[model samples]
Target: MNAAIHEFTAERLAGGDQSIGAYAGKVLLIVNTASNCGFTPQYEGLEALYQRYRERGLEVLGFPCNQFGSQEPGEADEIASFCQKNYGVSFPMFAKIEVNGDDTHPLYRYLKKAAPGLLGSESIKWNFTKFLVNRQGEVTARYASATSPEAIAGDIEKLL
Candidate 1:
């Protein structure tokens, strides 16, 4: 399902399945999150980005993942509460998904293909790896976990 971001469907943490098409015509920041990863603190900067640019047309989509060292083992409710209570995360988060390997989610497969990481590697190295998508739903940039959310602010601002 490479390059399938335009056609992938995700089951929302809130309840049902929805198409990535729903986010068409908007800039999207997609991240793989883990509750216990060292970079988990990025959730705050992500939330800040969301709050600051959403009205101007930015949507940050967080996908909890346990594939990276079982860092995000919480159930749906627990995950939601952690994000809300700690980071005040108000953006949409989907069900936990595998970002790489044979079971990789369709959306992630699309992203990994569009904007590969360091040295053009398709595998996700760690938690908080991000993909930035433009209004046309084209994957534009990719940021590694160590690349903080604040660092990507300019790119997002450019898209807006």
Candidate 2:
């Protein structure tokens, strides 16, 4: 586990501060999401994974991002409503954030550095890019936007 991740924090969509330390010792599927993107439907699969493994120490953390074609243009409440009404999402979701560029969230900065994408790229390619973290908080793998949530179940199971 990298000591840096635990030092970061994010604002919950519902309003409140969330510390990465809270998920220590838990396997995490951290994703950069966009509500209106073509990959938006992946929310259903993400929720399914959360429901299936949450009891086994899995925490699926969603972070909305509008960086990709202004896909997630909603406010915090709207994002919350969209997730709940459309996907029945019950996992923790954070406020909108930048996954790339200079203003990227501290947590994301650490994640991209820890698990660069294909060709060793540190920048996020698109929304729904997922980062798999081990129970100890070390990033084990990085999945691209085209990688369906179900496709990573086997890797997650290994972590669990």
The per-candidate count of clashes, in order, stands at 0, 0
> What is the per-residue lDDT of model 2 for residues 67-130, given as tens digits with 9 covering 90 to 100?
9999999999999999999999999999999989989999999999999988899999999999
Error of 1 at 136 (Å): 0.7
Range of the 10 consecutive residues with the lowest summed lDDT in candidate 1: 1-10
**Could you list the CA RMSD of all candidates, in the order they appear?**
2.3, 1.0
lDDT of 1 at 51: 94
TM-score of each: 0.95, 0.97
Report lDDT (Cα) of residue 31, candidate 1.
Answer: 94
Best by TM-score: 2
Steric clash pairs (candidate 1): none
Q: Score each candidate by Cα lDDT.
A: 0.91, 0.94
Q: Write the residue-wise lDDT of candidate 1 on 44-127 in tens digits.
A: 999999999999999999999999899999988899999999889999999988998999998888889889888999999999
